[model samples]
Target: MNIVIIGGGGFLGQKLARALVARGTLNGTAISRITLADVNDPAGIEGASLPVETARCDITDPASVARVVTGETDVIYHLAAVVSAHAEEEFEDGMQINLFGTLNILERCRKLGTAPLMVFTSSIAVYGGEVPDPITETSLLNPQTSYGAQKAAGELLVNDYSRKGYVDGRGVRLPTISIRPGKPNRAASSFMSSILREPLNGQAANCPVGEDFLHYYLSPRKCVENLIRTAEIPAADLGRNRILQMPGRTLSIRQMIDAMSAVAGPEPARLITWQPDEAISSIVAGWRFDIHADRALALGLAADASFEENVRYYIEDDRPGN
Candidate 1:
C-alpha cells in the first residue's frame, strides 16, 4: 500500500508516521511507501522500519498537492491546518489551508478515479456555540470561531466526496490532546499541554483559563492511535457519514494540576500561574468539554485511561534526560 501523510512536520503527524513505519503495515497490507508531505521538509522524519519518502507539498497549491497525492497513493491522512487561535487571527489563510486545501485533495482523488481511503483530521472545535451536553454524531454543527467554521466545512467536504464515491474518506474530530511535547504554538489549546509541559521542564507557564474550566483531552499516544484506527476501519462499517468523533477524557485544570503534583511534585505544579488571557478564554469558552463520543468508542477507538496516565506518559516518552 502507498500512504501519504500531509502536515507530517507537526508533532502528531510525526508520531503517526513513526507508528505506521513501526508497524510496517496497515489494514493487513504491507506498505510499499510512506510519503510525509509538508510545506517545508519535515525535520527528523526518518522511517527505519519501512520505505519512507519526504516532499515539500503546499496544501494550498493544487499542483503541489497533486504532485504528492498521485493515482498510486492508496491512503491519505490530511492533517494540515492553521490552528484555532491562529486561524481566528488569519481568516483567509485558515480558509486557504483548511477548506480549499482539503478541496484540492478531494478533487485530486476524484480525478484519479481510485477512491483512495482519505482520512481528514477535523477538530472538536466544530461543536462550539450552543452545543448539546454530550455532543454526538447526530448533533448539529454550529461553529463559532473561524477555525471551527473551516473544520466544519472540511467535514462536509469529506462526507460529500465519500458519498459521491470519489474517495473512501473518514473525517475524525480530534479532542484536545494534552501533554503535547513541543514548543507552544498559536493553538488556543496549546495552554492545555503547556501547563504540564513547561512546568515539568522547570519553566513557569500561565494558565489562561480557571481551574473550574473543563475540556475534553487525550494523550498524544492515543491521539495518534485513534488516527491510525480511523484508517483501519472498513468503509462499509463507517457507513455513509464517514466521520468519527474521537474519544477523550473530560477533566478540569484543577484535576490536571492535582495529577501533576502526584506524578512529579508540588514544586512543578506551583510553577503554574493562573493569569487569564481573554483571547484564549473566549476561543475555548464555547467548547463542549463533556463530550460522550459514543460512536468512536463503539468503533474501537480508545481514549486516555486517565489524566494521570497522560502526565506520566509525557514524563516517560518526551521528558528530557529520559
Candidate 2:
C-alpha cells in the first residue's frame, strides 16, 4: 500500500509516519512506500525497512498538492490546516488553506477517479451554540469561530465528495489533542498541551482558561491509531454519510492538572498558574466538550483510558528527553 500524509512535518503527522514504519502495513497490506508531504521536508524519519519519502509541497497551491496526491496513491491522510487561533487571526490565510486547500485535495482525488481513501482530520470545534450535554452523531453544527467554520465546511465537502463517488472520503472530527510533545502553536487549545507539557519539562505555562473549563481530548497515540483504523474501514460499511466523530475523553482543566500532579508530582503541577484570557475563553466556551461519539465507538475506534494515562504516555513516548 502506498500512503501519503499531507501534514507530515507536524507532530501528529510525524508520529503517524513512524507508527506506519514500525507496523509495516495498513489494513493488512504491506506498506510499499510512504510519502510525507508538507511545506517543508519532514525530518527525524530514518532507518525504516520501507522507503519513506519526504516532499515539500504547499497544499494551497493546487499544482503542488497535485504532485503529492495522484491516482497511484492508495490512501491519503489530510492533516494539513491553519489551526484555530491562527485561522481566527488571519481570516484570508485560514480560508485559503483550510477551505480552498481542502478543495484542492478533493478535486485532485476526483480527477484521479481511483477513489483513493482520503482520511480528513477535522476538529471538535465543528460543534457549538446550545450544544447538547453529550454531543452525538445527530447534533447540528453551528461553528462559532473562523477555524470551526472552516473545519465544518471541510467536513461538508468530504461528505459530499464521498456521496458523489469522487473520493472514498472519511472525516474524523478530532478532539483537542492534549499532552502534545512540542512547544505551543497558535491553536486556541494550545494551552491544553502546554499546561502539562511545559510543567513536565520543568517550565512554567499559563492557563488561559479557568480550572473548571472543559473540553474533549485525545492523546497523540490514540489519534494516530484511529487515523490508521479509519483508513482500513470499508466504504460499504460507512453507508452514505462518510463522517465519524472520533471518540475522546472529556475532562475539565482541574481534572487534567490533578492527573499531571499525580504522575509528575505537585512541583510540576504547581508551575501552572491561572491567568485567563477572555478571547481564548470566549472561543472555547462555545465548543461542545462532552461527546458520545457512538459512531466511532461502533466502528472500533477507542479513546485514551484516562487523562492520567495520557500524561504517562506522553512522558514515555514523547517527553523531550526521552
Candidate 3:
C-alpha cells in the first residue's frame, strides 16, 4: 500500500520515515511506496528496503497538496505545521498551512471516495485557559497562541470530515517531544530540547523558561511509536471520537537538568545559560500541559519513563555515530 508523510523533511518526520523503513510495513499491509513530502526533500535518507518518493510540495497550495495524495494512498501521517513562535509572528502563513493545509487534505480524501486512515499530529498547545490539574481527554480547547488555535480548529475539521465518512481520520495531540536531534529553530520550546541536546553536543544553550516551570514531555522514540500505533488502531474501536490525547510525564526544567547531570555528568549541565525571554516565558506560561491521557494509555501508548531516559535514548541512538 502507498503511504505519505506530510512533513517528512522535519526532525520527527525524518525519524518516523526511518522507523517505517526499518519496519518495512504498516499495520499488516506491506508498504509498496512511501512518499516523503515537505518544502524540501528529506536529505540522506532514501528508502532502504522499498522505494521512497521524496516530493517538494507546499502544503498551503491546493494544487501542490493534490500531487501528494492519490487513490493508492491507504494511510497518511500529517506532521506539517507552522510552529508556535513562527505562527504567532506570521499569522497568514500559519492559517494557510496549519488550518487550510489540513482542510485541503480532507477535501482531497473526500474526492478520492475511499476511507483511508489519516493520522494528524496535533499539539499540547490546544489546551490553555484554566485547564484541569491533570489535563484529560475531555478538556476544553482554549488556546492562547495562534499555533494552538489553528491546531484546535484543525482537530475539529478532522473530526467533522471523519464523521462525514470522507476519511477514517485520527488526530493525536502530541506532547512536547524532548531531546530532538537538531539545531535550534524559532519554536519558543526549542530550548526545552536544546538545553539538553546542545549541551550534550558540547555547545552552550539558553534556558528560556524558569527552573520551576513544569510541562509535559515525550521522547522522539515514543512519539514515532505512538504515531504508528495511531495508524494501526481500528476505526470501529475508536467509534465517533477521532482525536486521541497522547500520554506524557510532567517535569520541571530543573528536573531535566538534573537528569542530564546524572546521565552525562556535571559538564553537560554546566553549559546552560539562564537567559529568560519575556515573550517566550509568556507563551509557555499561557500553556497548560499536564496530561493524564487514559485513552492513549489503554491503546498501549506510553511516555518515556523519566527525563533521564529521554536524554539517554538520544545519547545511544542519535549521538555522532555507532
Candidate 4:
C-alpha cells in the first residue's frame, strides 16, 4: 500500500509516520511506499525500515496539495492545522489552514476518481459550548473558539464527501494529547506538556488553568494507534456519520500533575506554578471534558488506561537524554 501523510513534519505526524514505518504493515496489509508531505521537509527520519518519500506541499493551496497527492496513493492522513491558540489569535490564518486546507484535500480526493481512505485528525474542540457529560457521537456541536469551529466544519465536510462517494473518509476526534515531547508551541494546551517536560529538565513552567479544571486526554502513542485503526475499520461499520469520538481518560489538571509527579518527582511538580490566563481559560472552558467513545471502543480503537500511564510513556520514550 502507498500512503501519504500530510503535515508529516509536525510532532504527532512524525510519530505516526515512524510508527507506520516501524510496523511496516497495517491490518495485515503490507505498506509498500510512504510519502511524507508538509510545508517543511520532515527531519530526523533517516534509516527508515521501509521505502519512504518526502515532499514540501502546502495543504492550504489546492494546486500544491494536488501535485503531491496524485497517482496511486492508497491512504491519506490529514493532520495539518494551525493549532488552537494560534487559531484563536489569528482567526483568518486558522480558517485558511484548518478549514480550507481540509477542503483542498477532499477536493483533490474527489478528482482522483479512486476512493482512497482519508483519515482526518480532528480535535475534541469540536464538542464545545453547552456539551453534555460523556459527550457522545450524537452530541450537537456549538464551538465557541475559532479552532473548534474550523475543526467542526472540517468534520462536516469529511462526512458530506463520504456520503457523496467522493472519498472513503473518517474523522477521528482526538482528545487533548498529553505528555508531548519537546518544547511547547503556541497551542493553549502546550502548558499540558510544559508542566511536566520543563520541570524534568530543571526549568520552570506555568499552569494557566485551575487545578480543578477537568479535561479529556490521550497519549501520543494511543493517538497514532487510533489514527491507524480508523484507516483499518470498514466503511459499512462507520455508516453515514464518518466521525468517531475517540476513547480517552477524563481527569482534572491536578490529577495530571499528580500523575507526573508520581513518575518523575516532587521537584517536577514544584516547577509547575498556577497562573491563570483569561484568554486560554475562556477558550478551554467551553471544550468537552469527557466522551463516550462507544463506537470507537467497539471498533477496536484503543486508548491509554490512565493519565499516569500516559506520563510514564512520555518519560520513557521521548524524555531528554534518553
Candidate 5:
C-alpha cells in the first residue's frame, strides 16, 4: 500500500511516520511506498526498513497537492494546518491552510478516480457553543473561534466528498494532547503542555486557566495509535457516520497539577501560578469538556488510562532535559 502524510514534519506527523516505519505495515497492508509532504523540506530518514519519499508542497495550492497525489496512494493522512491560536490570530492564513488546504486534498482525491481512504486530524475545538459533559458524536458544532470554524467546515467538506463516493474519508476530533515536546507553539492549549513540560525540566510555567477549569486530554502516542486504527478499520464498520470523536479522559487544571506533583514533586507544582487570559479563556470556554467516544471504542480504538499516564509517557518517551 502506498501512503501519504501531508504534514509529516510536524510533531504528530513525525511520530506517525516513525510508528509506521517501525511496524513496516498496517493490518497486513504492505506499505510499499510512503510519501511525506510539507512546506518545509523534511529531512530524509536513514535506515528506513520501507521505501520513503519526501515532497515540498503547499497543501493550500490545489496544483501542488495534485502533483503529489498523482500516483497510486491507498491512504492519505491530512495533518496540515495552522493550529488553533495561530489560526485565530491570523484569520486569512488559517482559512487558506485549514479550510482550503483540506479542500485541495479532497478535490485531488476526487480527481484521482481511485477510492483511497483518508484520515483527517480534526480538533475538539470543532464542538463549541454550550456543549454538555460527555459530548457525543451527534453534538452540534457551534465553533466560536476562527480555528474551530475552519475545522468544522473541513469536517463538512469531508462528509460531502464521502457521500458523493469521491473518497472514503474519516474525521477524528482530537483533544488537547498534553506534555508535548519542543518549544510551545501558538495554540491556546499550549498552557496545557507548559504546566507540565516546564516543571518537569525544573523550570516555571504559567497556568492561564483556573484550577477548577476542566478540559479533555489525550497523549500524542494514543492520538497516533487512534489515527492508524481509523485508517485500517473496514469501511462497512464506518457506515454513514464519517466523523467520530476520539477517546480522552477529562480532568481539571488542579488534577493536572496534582499529577505533576506526584511525578515531579511539589517544587514544580509551586512553579505553577494562576494568571488568566480572557482571549484564551473565552476561546477554550466554548470547548467541550468531555466526550463519550462510543463509536471509536466499538471500532477497537483506545486511549490512555488517565491524565497521569499521559504525562508519565511523555517524560519517559520524550525525556526533555532541564
Candidate 6:
C-alpha cells in the first residue's frame, strides 16, 4: 500500500516515517512506497527498505496537497499544523495551515472516492477551562487556544467526512509529547521538553510554568507506537465515533523534574530555573488534560510506564550524539 506523511520534515513525522519504513507494512499490507510531503522538503532516509519519496507540499494550497494524495495512496498521516504559541501569534497562518489545510487534505481524499485511511493527529489542548479530572470519552471540547480550536474543528471534519463515506478517518487527540529531542520550537508546551532536554544536556533551561502545574504527557517512542496502532484498529470497532484520546501519563512539572533527577541525578535538575511567563502560563492553565483513555486502552494502545521511562527513552533513542 502507498502512504503519505504530511509535515514529514518535523521530528514526529520523520520518526513516524522511519518507523513505517522499518516495519515495511501497515495494517498487514506491505507498503509499496511512502511520500513524505512538507512545506519544506523532508530529509531523505538513507538505504530505506522501501521507496521513500520527499516532496514539498503546501497544504494550504489544494493543488499542492492533491499532487501527493493520489488514487494509489492507501493511508495518509496528516501531522501538519502551525502549533500552539505559533498559531496564537500568527492567526492567519494558523488558520490557513491548521484549519483550511486540513480541509484541503479531506477534499483531496473525497475526490479520490476510495476512502483511504486518514490518521489525523489532534491535541489534548481541545479540552480547556472547567473540565472533569478524568476526561472521559463523552467530555465536551471547549478549546481556549487557537491551536486547540483548530484541532477540535479538524476532528469534527474528520468525523463528518467519515460519516459521509468520503474517507476512512481516525482522529487521535495526542497529549503533550515530552522529552522531544533537539531544540525547542515555538509551542507554548515546548517547556515540557526543554526543561528535561536542556538540563540533561548540561545546559540551563527556563521553566515558564510552576512546579505544581498539571498536564498529561507521553514519550516520543510511545507516541509513534500509538499512531501506528491507531492505523491498525478496525473501523467496525470505531463505528460512528471516529476520535479516540491516546493514553498519557499525567504529571505535574515538579513530578517531571523529579523523574529526570531520578534518572540523571540532581545536577540536571539544578540547571532548571523557574521563571514564569504569563502568556505561556495563561495558555497552559486553560488546558485541563487529566484523562482516562478507556477507548484507547481497550484498543490495546498503551501509555508510557512512567516519566522516568520517558527520560531513559530520550537519552538512549534521541539525545544528541547518543
Q: All models: lDDT? A: 0.89, 0.90, 0.87, 0.86, 0.85, 0.92
TM-score of 6: 0.96
- lDDT score for residue 314 of model 2: 94
Please, what are the lDDT tens digits per residue for candidate 4 over residues 243-274? 99888888888898888888877888888788
- Candidate 5: list runs displaced more than 4 Å: 131-133
User: Candidate 2 lDDT, tens digit per residue, 28-60?
Assistant: 999999999998878848798899999998999
lDDT of 5 by residue, 1-322 (tens): 8889999888888888888998889868778888888999876567889988889979888999987777588889999989877887789999999999999999998888896889998988887776665578888888877888999999999988998988899999898888788776677788988888887877788888788998888889899999999898887888887888888888898898898778766888887777888988986776778688889989978878877787788887786652
TM values, all candidates: 0.96, 0.96, 0.96, 0.95, 0.94, 0.96
| lDDT winner between candidates 5 and 6 | 6
Q: Which stretches of candidate 2 lie over 4 Å from their true place?
A: none
Error of 5 at 181 (Å): 1.3
Q: Give the lDDT of residue 316 in candidate 1.
A: 86
lDDT of 3 by residue, 137-193 (tens): 888888888999999999999999999999999999999989888788888788899
Residue 227 displacement in candidate 6 (angstroms): 0.6
List candidate 6 stretches off by more than 4 Å: none
Q: Report lDDT (Cα) of residue 315, candidate 4.
A: 76
lDDT of 1 by residue, 9-116 (tens): 888888898888888899999988888999989864553677788899998999999899998999999999988777888889998998899999999999999999
User: Using alpha carbons, what is the TM-score of model 5?
Assistant: 0.94
- In candidate 3, the residue pairs with backbone N, CA or C atoms under 3 Å apart (3 or more residues apart, or in different chains) clash, namely none
Q: Which of candidates 3 and 4 is the stronger one according to lDDT? A: 3
Residue pairs that clash (backbone atoms under 3 angstroms), model 1: none
Question: What does each candidate score in C-alpha RMSD?
Answer: 1.4, 1.4, 1.5, 1.6, 1.8, 1.3
- Root-mean-square deviation of candidate 2: 1.4
- Which residue pairs in candidate 4 collide? none
Q: Is candidate 2 or candidate 4 better by lDDT?
A: 2
On lDDT, the leading prediction is 6
Name model 3 segments beyond 4 Å from true: none
